[model samples]
Target: MSAEVSGVRIGVEERRARLRARQLAAVDDVAEVVEGLVALHATDPATVFLSVAARLCRPSGAIAAVEEALYGSGSGPGSGPALVRMMAMRRTMFVVSRESAPDVFAAAGRDIAARERTKLLEHLARGGGWDAAWLAEVEAEVEAALDRHGESGGARLSALVPRLREQVVVGRGKPYETTQNVASRVIRVMAAEYRIERRRPAGSWTSGQFRWARAEPLPERPVGPAREAVVRAWLRAYGPGTEADLKWWTGWTLTEVRKALKAVGAETVRLDDGAGHILPGHILPGDTEPAEPPPPGPVLLPGLDPTPMGWQDRDWFLPRSHRAELFDGTGNVGPTVWWGGEVIGGWAQRADGSVVWRQLTDRGAEAAGAVDRAAAELVGLLGGVRITPRFRTPLERELSA
Candidate 1:
């Protein structure tokens, strides 16, 4: 059917091209790359660096550049760090541009903080018989400890506030039931509330353990306007997406999703799944006027990379047949191998510090060679530093073994 009748059909090729172009595949500037993606998934600390490396035109010095952009160099914006890592959207951590942090905080972080606080309180009451007043006192104590120490680790703060050392039973009667301290949960809530911020790690970029500091005041904007701004930015980066996609990505209600879209005046377009919304004035190119596709150089994206997790409907870029192999039971994606914007397979590092991949589809000898070259480059990048994913998929498990 014609695009006019079908509503601007965005075919696979166009989608692939857009992925390469918009994702900054050939760009080397770390700050700009992170800004373009809006947020780089920071759940796995290494994912931020690995994701930047994958998109750079040249991977050399990529890690240093990412660190500089993340921690800053006592300058501002271009010369210094313009991004800040914060927990937002589905309670996942992301490295968002400093300029965008306020909006993201208002749009999703505040609500998540509220839910998390309520949940933590319930857990405390049920698991430890702690009441709201006790929780409040503990939070105040923890905040005070952070203030006194000025950028301390969770363990340190827990040490300062003895109540933080108290344990609570989680998943009682379940096989995975375990006792956990209340320290991390309280700190996480404070971070989401913008009462504190997570600074650099105690060790390398791959370290998950972070030091916490009192957060600087962000420019205050109303939640409504902030939500609208966040939605607009999301559409610019991952548009032509369904309302469901926005809701899932932002952790907002259906009503909120509709409201944000309306506020942004998002335009609708046809997708293989259903009607999708794009930013106003965005027109998908037709087959007759197709854009040139990016060179089919293979790329190894770290697990939970934003490109793989950007949308709710991923069939346009990731094939259905490969889903089970590439993603874990929790729907978390592992390290993915991409060629021409489609997920062809997954990659993992071996015991010998070499990267190995299993191609689920045969994309000809040329593509295979390119993938091999990419794997070699990744191995060199690692320099014998064995990296393990926090969430391991079956394929990754098999390959690493």
Candidate 2:
């Protein structure tokens, strides 16, 4: 065991203050919020909007700004599609800042894309006597169709290229066996390869049906440098985390994680859980200002908010007792309630379009009142437009019922 460093402790309160200061909480700008956290979980379409809404001090302006950042064009210099939705880290979809997209693609997405492509090819081969030439021809046809028609939905593209309509068996003979449409797989491959992008939804913001557009070529970056850059950014925002946390978050091999940390010159520190790493100069002094911690108040974070999903080791902010209730079977989190930077419970909107919550811990009456007020504010923000989590947890399901 490494010797513990006295007076270098980062308690829960200190972490909470960092959350507010770093724009994880009480933030106002959508781009800045996304940039600060590096990315927002976007597996659920609603998660992107709700995540941004929860952080904005003024929730009224959040929707328009977030929409612009996500879908708007360059009206002026340095302002074109401020953020992009991409498949990265852990093979999950994330809304990443445009400035960070290239690095993310190079660092994490490229490998996953390769694996997906290989897997798809194998499945295709199993279905018939498909070869690499067939895949190339299909890809060319799909690209040509998109080029001629501009942005299109998967169904439209499938109509244009009849081959895309073919089905492939996945997990055959297994309990969870299912068939997958070749159109969806091709589209996924195109997106992962950075050859295409998902534009605005075909329906409302809550809809998952996205139109596809040709992607602008990403600026070239070497994999090593890109991995180091992303790792450094993550450490700065959610650091003092264990190697396991870094590996889990990035989906990188242990060797890759170690190399990236060494490349970034991360310093080792003793976390309550175990040894963790942080960027140099990130340590706070023993007698820093703001003697008392700031009141984090109550925040209703969306499902898969980066703050909660940021680390594999979540004991610092998430209580162990509430894990099963807050997270789904696949380990995806639901909409959560935060008080002073710690997740105290979970919340949900009833069918009547009212937001309700269940506090798992004995938070004081003052905290409870604040949480209630926050929930009411969130309900007002929605204006009776009830939102649902893509992956619902037990507590959220119970409360919503």
Candidate 3:
């Protein structure tokens, strides 16, 4: 319907325009796409590459463009258009522009690291004779091992630092209790702190099994300004979103969300569900005709694509009935077909490397034809490389099958 600014309703068409204007199109480059959207959701390895492929004017070599920007900097740490895969908001993995990486770390990664560190220490204590000092010592040993080889997997690092191989019990009294080696967990903590990074995996880009390498820590900045910058970017890219949406996306508390919004001088707007915020001075079209929005999209976006996952409240852009079919129980989205600003269907690649799709709702024949062209083009672009969503959903399963 319409969004409210001082009780003035901003229409959905206007909302769609705001987002598309900030997003990259075929004319844009890899860095622009990654930075424009704040970051590309990278929980699924193929998601990052496929997202880029969808936005480029020429899908050919777009995958390489993403790789060059992300791993191109070097096995070592540096920043520019270069991208870094790091854990951010909601503890989900994302590939963000290197320039904004530091602020993202300050705003979200640092908090995640601190919380994870605390939990890890508590787990260590229960294991007996292990504490922060022990963790530090082992972390150093792991780093030293990485330096020796330049890149190493958890298995190698664990062997090098025997302490890493030591077991710790978690969920001690719970039904799902299990034991884990300290190796991978420690590496994750270091990554959260920016002490090291995951380099490209030894296998195809689709593989999540990645290796680790020592990385220069992210440049430090005060949390206040950093959070402000991050919030500003979020509002600019995904604006007119409610506090709950930002809170759910960023995993920040209401206080932190409010403070950041104030620092950015964000303006409150009325959304269908409740109040939302937009960057100051962002003028929504008056009740008159909304500025001609971008043409309807038939782009095929991978599962966990950032757009759908950008907000907790999905009603404005997502069909209510299709939610269960497209999304997993925990909210990760599967490969979705977007016909303009809304999700119209879901697609999956068959085992034979052909793409198959099922419309959750008919979008008319013309839209269906466009969807077909997009799917066929993706088949050729993939060149027979198949993808399986890291998080599978009912519709994707049915379509692929």
User: TM-score for every candidate vs. truth?
Assistant: 0.88, 0.90, 0.90
Candidate 2, residues 1-401: lDDT per residue as tens digits?
12234445555556656655564556668976887788899999888888898878788778778888898864677656778888999999999988899999999999999998998788788764577788888888888888999878888889999998877777778898787777887788889998889888798888899988788788988999999989888876776567788889999998998888777766655455422433212222222333243565888898888888987877767778889999999999998998876788899999999999988876799999999998988888888777889999999899999
Candidate 1 clash pair list: none
Error of 1 at 281 (Å): 14
Query: What lDDT score goes with residue 68 in model 1?
Result: 79
Model 1 lDDT tens row, 13-73: 6766777767736785886787768789999999999999988877877888888777767
Kindly report which residue stretches of model 3 are placed more than 4 angstroms away from their true locations once superposed. 1-8, 73-81, 170-178, 272-293
Per-model C-alpha lDDT, please?
0.80, 0.80, 0.79
Give per-candidate clash totals.
0, 0, 3
- List runs of model 2 lying over 4 Å from the truth: 1-7, 73-79, 169-180, 274-294
Candidate 2: minimum summed lDDT over ten consecutive residues — where? 279-288
